[model samples]
Target chain A: MGIEFQNVNKTYPDGTVAVDQFSLHVPSHTSTVLLGSSGCGKTTLLRMVNRMVDPSSGAVLIDDEDVAGVEPVALRRRIGYVMQNSGLLPHRRVIDNIATVSRLNGVAKAAAHRRAHELMETVGLDSALAQRYPGQLSGGQQQRVGVARGLAADPNILLMDEPFGAVDPLVRLELQRELTRIQSELHKTIIFVTHDIDEALTLGDQIVVLKKGGEVAQIGTPQQIVESPADDFVAQFLGLDSARRTLSAAPRDDGGWFVSDAQGRPLGVVDSLPQHPGQNA
Target chain B: MAWILDHLPRILELSLAHLLLAAPAIAAAFLVAVPIAWAANRVRPLREIVVSGTGLLYAVPSLPLFIVLPIILGTGVRDTLNVIVALTIFGLALMVRSAADALDSVDGGVRLASTAVGYSAALRFFTVELPLAGPALLAGLRVVSVSTISLVSVSAVLGVQSLGSLFTDGFERGIVPSIVAGIAFTAVLALLLDLLLVAAGRLTMPWVKGGRR
Candidate 1:
C-alpha cells in the first residue's frame, strides 16, 4: 500500500521542531528511501506512517485512509517495523521472536511456529538457530532474525530505520543484497531510513533527500539526484563536491579504461567505451 | 554439642517453626512487591513515593513492629500471625525497591521492539518485560530470602517460639554452645533458601545459563 504524509509537523514539548511541514508520497511496491544525517528528522517522518509518533499537525494516510482514524495498535500491527541494533528480545528464542506478531494476532502456537520456520528460511537464517536466544547469535545473524521477525506478520508496508547500520561493511553489503532480492520477490511498499547515501542509492527506487526539520532537499531517482543535486546542501551531503564522489577516467594500456577517484585511487576499470563517444553531442 | 544432642528434638521443632514463619512472609512479600514495582515503574512521581515510602518500613524496629502489630491487627503479641505480618512488612521494604530496579534493568530497545511487534501493554509486561527482568529479580529475591530467614529470629524477643529462643535461653544459662548452634542453624537455613532460589532461577531462566552472550 502507498503512504502519504500531508503537511506533517512534529514538535517536542521542550519546543524542538523535529519535523516541519513535511509531505511525501511513497508509492506502493517500491522502496522509497528517506536519506539524511542524524537530526534531520528522517526517522521521525518514517515513524509517522505507523503512528509510532503522531504528528503535531497534519495527517498521515495509508491508501487514502487517514491513519488518525485507525487505532494506533491496530494500525501498527499491519505495518512491519525494523529498527537499528536488531532490537530482538534477549530472553526469547529466535523462533518465538519471529512468531511474536503472529501469536499476538492470535495465530495458534503450532501454526505460528510453522510460519516462523518458513520466515527464518525466507530471511536466509538457518533453522538450527531457531531454538537459540538472540544473544547467542552473531550480530549479522541477529539482524537476519530481526528481518525475519519483521516479515513474519507479512504486512504490506515495511518500515526500516537503518536496519543494517550496526553490522560490518561486508555484512551490511550482504544484507542489502538480500533485502533487494527479497523486495524483488515480495514487492512490499518499503520506507527505508538511512544516513548513508550509497545505501539509499543501492536500495531506493525513489530517494527523498531530506534536510534539517525534514525539509525536502531533493526527491528523485538516484541518478537524477547524483547528476543534478537540488541545492548545495544536497550536493554536499552526497559528497558530490568531494574527491570521493568525483571520478577521473584514464585510458589503459589495454582496451579497457581505468576509472579512479580525484586522488588517483583506483575505483574500477570500464571494460568497453560507449558505442558512440560524445553521443549527447 | 552435648546440649544440642539432648535437645535435638526441641531444636528440630524450633527450626520447623522458624521455616513456617519465614516462608509465608517471603512468598507474600514477592507477590505484593511485583504489582507495586510494576506500578512504580510506570510513573516517575509514584516511583519515588513507593520506593522511599516502603523503604521506611524497614526502619521500624522489629520488636516494636511485633509489639505494635497486635493492636493494629487485633492479634496477641506472641501470636505467630503477628510475627509473620511484621516480617512481610520488612520484606516488602527491601523487595519493592529491588523489584523496581530489576524492572529498570530491562533493555529499552527490547521493550520498544515488543510494543512495535503488537504486544498489548499488559501482555508485554508479563511475557517480555517480566521475563527479561528475571535474573535481576532473582538476585533481589535471594537477598530478601536470606534477610527474611535471619530476621525471623527477631520475633523471639516478643515471646514467640522460634530457633531464636535458643539464643535467649543460652544467654540466661551462660551456654555459649547453644548460642553458637542457633547462629549455625540460621546461617544454614539462609544458605538452603538461597540455593533453592538459584535452582528455581536456573529452571525458569534457561537463557541465562550456559554462559550465553
Candidate 2:
C-alpha cells in the first residue's frame, strides 16, 4: 500500500534541524525516488516509514493507518529496508542472511532456507552461493543478496537508501536495471532515496526533488522535470544550464542530432538552446 | 627438564588443579563479561567509565584479592573457589573492556542494516553483533586465558595447593628442581591454552579466513 507523510518534522536533540514540515506521498506499486544533495534529510524521511527515526511532529500513514500507532518491530517486519554497501550480516551464509526476516518471524529453518534459495535466483544469483558467507561475495553479489533479503518476506513496501552507491559504475547500472525488472514483476511500493540525479531520473517514476531543510523544491516524472524545471534552483541542481539542453525541433533534416548511447543505439533527440554564462546548449 | 620428568605424576596433579582453577574462572568470566560489555556498549556515557573501572579491578594485585577473598566471600582460606573468584574478577576487568572494544569494532553499516532488517534488539545482538564481535572477543579471551593460567600459581601462597606450591616448596627448602619444574610447566600450560582459544576462534568464524574469493 502507499505511504503518506503529513507535515512531518525532525529536529535532533542537539538543535540541528534534519527535516522540517515535510510532506509527501509514495504511491503504491511504483518507485518514488526522494532525490537531493547531502543534508536534505531524505534518509531521515525514509527511515520514518520503519519508525527508525520518529518525526518530531505530524504523522506518517501507511494505507490510512498512522505508522506511529503500529508497534515498531512489527511495522519493520512488514517493510523492507536496504542501504548502501549491502549491509549483509558477515557471520551469516547468503541463504541465512536472505531468510533472516522469515526466520525472525518463526518460519522453520528448512522452509526459510528454501525460500532464500529461490530468492537467490530471483535476484540473479547462483543457488550454489547459498551456503557461502557474505564476506565471500563481491560487492555486486552482496547488493543482490541485500535486495533478496529485503524481498524474502514479500513485503509490499521496500525502502532503498542509496543501495548501490558503493558499487562500480557498470555494476551499479546493472543493479539499477535489475531493480527495474524486479519492480515490473513484483509491483512493490518503493521509496528510493539517493543523491545522484542521474539515478533518480533512471529509476524514479515520480522524483521528489527535495531542497535543503527538507523542503520540496519540485516533484515530477523524470521527463517532466527535464522538460520543464520548476525554478532556477531546480534547473541548477539538475545541471541544466540553458546552453546545454533544449527541446527544440531545429535541424529537422538530421532529426535534431539524434543522441546515440555508448553502443551507438539512438538514446534520445537533443537540440541546442540559448547559451548560459558558463556554457552553451 | 629433568626435574619435570622425575616428578611427572606430581606435576600432572598440580597441572590438573591449575587447569581446574583457571578454566572455570575464564569460562565464568566470559559469561559474565559478555553481558556487562553488551550493557556498557548501550550506555555510551558510561562506556569508558565502566571499562576503566573494570580495568582498575584487573590491576588490583591478584595475590591480595585471592588472599582477602575468604574474608569478603566467607569461604575457607584454602578454598579453590577463592582463586576462581579472584581470577574471574581479573578476567572481567580485562574482558569487559575487551568485549566492549570488540563490539565497537563492528562496522556501523552492518549494525544499522541489522536493525533496518527487522531484527529485534536481542536477536540482533546474538545473530549479528555478537558474531561480528567474535574476532576481537576471542582475542580478549586469549589474553584473559593466558593470564588466568599463570595467576593460578599465586593462589598457592594462600595455602591452596597448586603449581605455585612448587615455587614455595622449592624456595623454602632451597630446592631448585621444584622451582624449575613449575616454571617449565606453567609456560607450557599457558601456550596450550592460547592455542586452544585460537583454534576455537578459527572454527567459529571461518569467514574471517581471508578476503572474498
Candidate 3:
C-alpha cells in the first residue's frame, strides 16, 4: 500500500468529528479518489497523510511507516499537495514558487530554477512567464503553476484537494485531461479528493465514497460503483436507480459501448472499458 | 530665490543635518515597528494594544515630546538625540499599525498554500508573507518619512539645530528673506524625499504595474 489508514479518527478542539474511524489502503502508482459531498471529511482525511491534520485515534502510514513519527516539514517536502484555488504565494514569481520544494530539498539555487523551468514545461506552462509573479497569471495558468510546484521535487505521492473545482468548465476539462496525460508518464501514487462523482469516475483507479459521518459508504472501482452500489445511498448518490441499473451495454460498430436507460434514452457511452471485466473483458 | 544662492552654504549644512537626523531615526523605527506589527498581526490582543498604543504616540504633541526626551533618556537637553528620539517615536507609532495591516491584507489562501507546500514557519514568514506585504508597508513608510521631515523642524524650538534653525536665525535678525528660504528649502526637501520613496517602491515591486493580469 502506498498509504494506509488504520481506523483513523479526528475531532476538532470544539468537538466536531471531521473524520471518524476512517480506514483504507490506497495502492501505489495509481490515482485513488476519496469522493464525498461537502463536510464528508474528504479533506480532513487527505491532510492526515501529510500530517497537516493529525488523526485523533489510530495512525496513518506511508509505505508502512507511521506518518506521526516523521517531522512535519520534512514529511511535507516529500509529498506534493495541490488545492482548489491554486494556493500560490502571491509574492513569489512563478519560477520561484515552482522551485520551492526543490529548494527545501537542498537543491542549489541555479539547479532548482533550472528544474522549475523544466517543470513549467512539464505542466504545459510557457517558460516565458517564468519571471512573472502569481498575480500576473490567469486562473488556469496559476493552477498549472500550482501543479508544477507540486511536482517540482518529484515526490512519490501527490495529493490534490478539489484541484479543478474552482475553474471554468472549459478550463477544468483541459486541466483534467492534462492531469491524465501527466499521470500516464509519471505513474505517481496520487490521492485525489473531489465531491464530483463524474470527476472521480473519470480519474480514479479505486474510489472511496464517504458518508456524512466520515464513514466509508463504499469502496470499489468506478464500474463496481455504477453497476452494483452497496445500498440505496450509493445508488442514489451515483444516480443509478433500479431502472437505470437494468439497462444494458452492447458493442457499437464504431468501437464504443452503446449504453441506454430503461426508456432507451442514451444515458452515456462507454468510449473504452479498461474498466470492468464483466462489461467487455 | 536670490537668498537661496546667498545662503546656499548654510542651506546645504542644515539640509545635511536634517537628513542625517531623520534617516537613522526612521531606520530605527522601521526595524522596531516591523516585528511589533508582525506580532500584532498574529496575536489578537497584541493587535489591539499595539495599534492603540501607536495611535496615542501619534497624538503626542511634538514639542513636549522633544522637551521630555532628554529627561527620559538622560541625554543633553538640546542634543540632536532629542529630535531623533521624538521622530523615531512618531515613526514607530505610524508604521507598526501600517505594517500589521499590510500583513493582514495578504491573501489567506496564499498563506495556507505556502504551508501546504512545505514552507517552514520562518521561510513562509520571510519569503511569502513579508514580500507580499511590501506595497502597504512602503505606503506606510512614505507617510512616516514625509511627516518625519516636517516634524524634524518642530524640534528646532528646543534649540537642537536642524533645517528649522533657519527659522530661528531668520526670526532673530528679522530677515524675512531667510525665513522664506527656510520654508522653500523644507518644501523642496520633503517633496524630493517623497519622490525617492515612490521610486524605490516602483523599483522593488515590478508586479504592481507591468503585468497584464
Runs off by more than 4 Å, candidate 3: A241-281
lDDT of each: 0.91, 0.89, 0.88
- Please give the distance, in angstroms, between residue B173's alpha carbon in candidate 2 and its true position after superposition: 2.4
Model 3 lDDT tens row, B131-175 = 789899889988888888888888777787788988988899998
Residues A180-262 of candidate 1 have per-residue lDDT tens digits of 99999999999999999999999999999998999999999999999999999999999999998899888889678999999
The count of backbone overlaps in candidate 3 is 0
Model 1 over residues B1-213: C-alpha lDDT tens digits? Answer: 898898889888988899999999999999899899989988988899999999999999888888889999999998988889999999999999999999999999888887777777888899989998999988889888999999999888767888898898888899998898899888988999899999999999988984466
Q: What is the lDDT of residue A36 in candidate 3?
A: 88
Best-matching candidate per lDDT? 1
What docking grade does candidate 1 earn?
medium
lDDT of 1 at A129: 91
Error of 1 at A170 (Å): 0.6
**Candidate No. with top DockQ:** 2
Q: Which regions of candidate 1 deviate over 4 angstroms?
A: A275-281, B210-213
CA lDDT, candidate 1, residue A197: 95
Q: Rank order by lDDT, top first?
A: 1, 2, 3
